[model samples]
Target: MTNNKNQNLLLRSEHVWKVFGDGNEKKTILKDMSMSVHEGEFVAILGPSGSGKSTFLRVLSGLIPPTEGHVYMHEKELQGINNEVSIVFQNFALYPWLTVRKNVALGLLHSTISEEEKEKRITDAIHAIGLKGFDDAFPREISGGMKQRVGFARALVVQPTILMMDEPFSALDVLTAENLRHELLTLWLEKKIPTKTIIMVTHNIDEAVSMADKVCILSSNPGEIRVELEGLPVETRMQKGSDHTELVDSIYQIMTNPKKNPQTILHDGNHIPITLEESPYQVLPQIGISKLKAYIKKLMLQGGKESIRELNTNISLDDLLPLIEMMDILGLGGVEENRLFLTELGDAYAHGNTEEEKQILKKQLIANVSLIQFIMQQLEDGKHTIHTSDVLKHLHAYFPHQDAIIQLKTALTMGIYAGLFSYNRQTGRISLIEN
Candidate 1:
């Protein structure tokens, strides 16, 4: 709920750095980041996958302490679980055994408010969130949408000064998510809830643009703030106007290719382009060679050429971006402006159903990916054998432990599909496949 007179600064972060691991394996998730949230504003932290949007939100909310720097509420240092805030998670995160009314009570578990007030709050919250009749229902009995409604009620029942959501609608289907987005915005704009401010983390461009009063775009891999956008008229929001379309396009461009100068594009001279110095770590996007081949086959099925919009159909931006980006990175796919182009090798692979595709992909990986080259050399040096854990530990020099494990998994998938390596999942070992 917005209050024009309550325009005072509510919360802010200063030089915050969130690092995981220690010593030589240390990886910084957020680097020297600082931002502010004022009263009566909906702020969206938007970024790509592995940009640490969730990590940053946890740090901002004081759910976890930052490794360096401070978060201040009203200019005072915040310590351990910001009491004024409440969060709704991406997953419903409800207790299956608890009834809706009882589940909502968890928000008041630490509050000193009397039992009568707590009951009234629960009743009001359940009604306001459109789950009035579901008070006695268990989470297992409700629809996915209703489960999420209960999530919102629990967060709001606390009467928080600041409300935060981490991809709250991500788990819902398209129609349900759209409906919830509208409902929440109505509640905030109509002042139905007591929350003075709202902060959300999302990878969706349209969701951020439609919902947020201020949009802070974040760059991946160290998750730096790329730009802060504001001043869109409230009336212009959610409207299918030129302004809305243009804003979405510009944001899409920035998200897709962060290095391009925003001011020079389309001769507008009125945009803020992202300009982060990309790190050297190889972020092997989780889409492996088999999936890549499937996409290529799909593209060939459509036609030799498909518009970007056509390819993006039925897929969310977060999932689709990594896949197309990986293809471009591996020199198998090309996107120039709005059109998608398949490489000659990619075309041939699409046409062939046999080992010809694997042979072509092997040559492509060896020529393009340095990580593949490094892994191949290690296999040769280790007498054509190595433990997957050993390679994972070696990768920790580049990524955090969890991320390094995922990188190894993606690389292994690519190596297997390319016929360049053999991996025994049962034994957790990798061996070279010399011709």
Candidate 2:
């Protein structure tokens, strides 16, 4: 019975390979990847761009079948979209023509249930997603963040046991995205409904480390799982920075080093054994990962979690090194190496040890890094969101500072108030979002 239960895998993929082209020249995006996410576990598949994380997600959700392997849910092989699974994409695939109520109800359109029951489910989903007041609002009229809520609500209305998300917060401004992440975590924790499993694909490492019970790191190409790390929930993780930071460092090592050890692998036949011994970071010029690790630790200790560019500037590194920059930009360190520190926002988030809480906090922090910097820069400039050149002028005021360009640009694009800044893509002028 125990074996049966384990075999009745909530979701399983064996030897999955998604090949795009035909024949011998076939391009394999996801190769020999097999993983099982049990019922009620929140799992995150993380990787850099083009890492096939998204492809893996689509296969698991039954949106696309793997060219090589097989997928099973409930121990029964899945041929198409699993009845127990629902996917939420980064684009928030809400119906522009439909109202929020109708959009959610669409999920159950194929069901034999009556209209009354459908409306009830829709209503419940709306409230669950904090869109009670906006039920009448069309997708076109609402903010990008709110539209995503509708998409989530629609997915939830079907009452799927598993949730598959792909960068759902990628489109929103930092504050709005953070707010959504919190709401989603709260709902997931409250267990108002029966969502037992969540498998999300994200480019954001911090999101993976914070929100997932288990984080699977995929290599850049061929999309293999380089490392799998467990995350403590937000409640438990934040108490000790050293321990958590170390845990993060280990994950960073797994990612930065292309070489994988046997310890990182699952014994299942689905996982591939890549025998490369060289570290990925070694390919780049040396800036000393330990130095960066120390720098970030020191910065976080002092600033908690502040702007990366500001922290880097304060530290006064002679060269604006790319490797360290990449580490922090990826959220492996408290501050992006030589960049920002953990802000008050980050400190509050790092406090959570639970995957759900950490995920929420991670999402919030990553999205807002730019927003916070922008806000701070605005305050320094004695005005709210202004044109890029105007901010550049302020950066120039900090003349002779090596990070003048890096700081100003990051501030403009990253941690600012989204509602307070509007960029005219055509004109190249940035204005504040009207309240």
Candidate 3:
């Protein structure tokens, strides 16, 4: 759905700065941020909570104006009446007492247009969102998923040129969220609205990868654009496999590693090569599980005395499992009392291929915390310890990622065992330790 003429840049933001409060109390959310989206492109803003993703969207949607910088649509400066923009919020924001039809029609009320036109728009929106049969149902009468559909319908009724969704699917159940995401992807692909542009804000890395043509990752604190990743979101997930595992590992590295640049040595006796500002995924140390397995095999065959831990020290359970699993999968390494040990295959590589193996042994042991922190990040400020389910709900407010929540539960279990917290899985009750 690209605008053929001036399709190069549908939306552009220059040095955007959103500040809150005043005088000494001022807080700058965005700092000198600049980016552009082409017409019909699904661009996603990926960041932790309080990273100013919502602020960016609000300014783009004309709900709030930026304190600094300017935004342009079709190369024209955007001011008040940017009619081509529409938004769907995470809270559903549907009128509880109003039926789906009326809720969707509320957006059209400001227009002087006749009721017939409004009805036609509302009906079309409902049908497009696959909620045709739920037109007469109130928000409470429908399921959470359907209520979100009403929200989408409400936004879609306006038929804006640009669609802004701030974690719109984050309120639904796991299955429902996945279903709605799939539906939206299908709609975007099939409909191909030429004037359409989508800018979605989400904390879920997978969602950004799954639906966006461009994924913009934001840094913390004074939220600023950190990096932009481009790739096609695979329609089907292949868990525990090389392709899938590699992508996940790469993303994890980019998000976690602080000192990303690393020194490297090649087989040609090249010593201390500098890698400047490369995506953590592209660095040799952060190679995928499958590639790591292959490299280990090659190194073992080379047969040289070298410490494996020195080469690869900063590996976490989450990213390291797949690598070890690959060793088991390929029959290259053996497990000894819950530890991974070099087998005949590994011993062979470690002995002979000193330099070549050294190249492969470069490891980035960037310390990363449990995935629970990622979920906790989605929550607003609160002091009380929350149940696992409640924590999951907070996660939904940003990224609707149930899998990450599961990881958080696993982390919580570990934390409990470490005396950091107390938990009972069966009851799902959790309490923080004073220490």
Index of the highest-lDDT prediction: 1
Q: Could you tell me which 10 consecutive residues in candidate 3 have the lowest summed lDDT? A: 262-271
Off by more than 4 A, model 2: 1-8, 237-244, 260-435
TM-score winner between 1 and 2, please give it. Answer: 1
Which digits, one per residue and each the tens of the lDDT, describe model 2 over residues 1-435?
011012234888998988786543355678788788887677889776667988899888888998988999977899988888888989888778998777888889887788888888888888888898997888899989888988898889888989889998878888898788777766776667668888889875555665666778787446776655666565543234665655555555455444446255334344334565442112222234345435545655775644433443454322223434434443544333323445454444345444433354335434445433444456446554455666555545432233344444443443222233556657655654433
Model 3: residue 275 alpha-carbon error in angstroms = 13
Tens-digit lDDT track of model 1 for 195-265: 99999999877888888888888876678887777635566776658887667666666665545555444
Best by TM-score: 1
- Candidate 3 versus the native: TM-score? 0.59
lDDT (C-alpha, whole model) for all candidates? 0.81, 0.63, 0.62
Q: Indicate the TM-score of model 1.
A: 0.80
Candidate 3 stretches greater than 4 Å from native: 1-6, 192-195, 233-245, 259-435
Worst lDDT run of 10 residues, candidate 1, spans 262-271
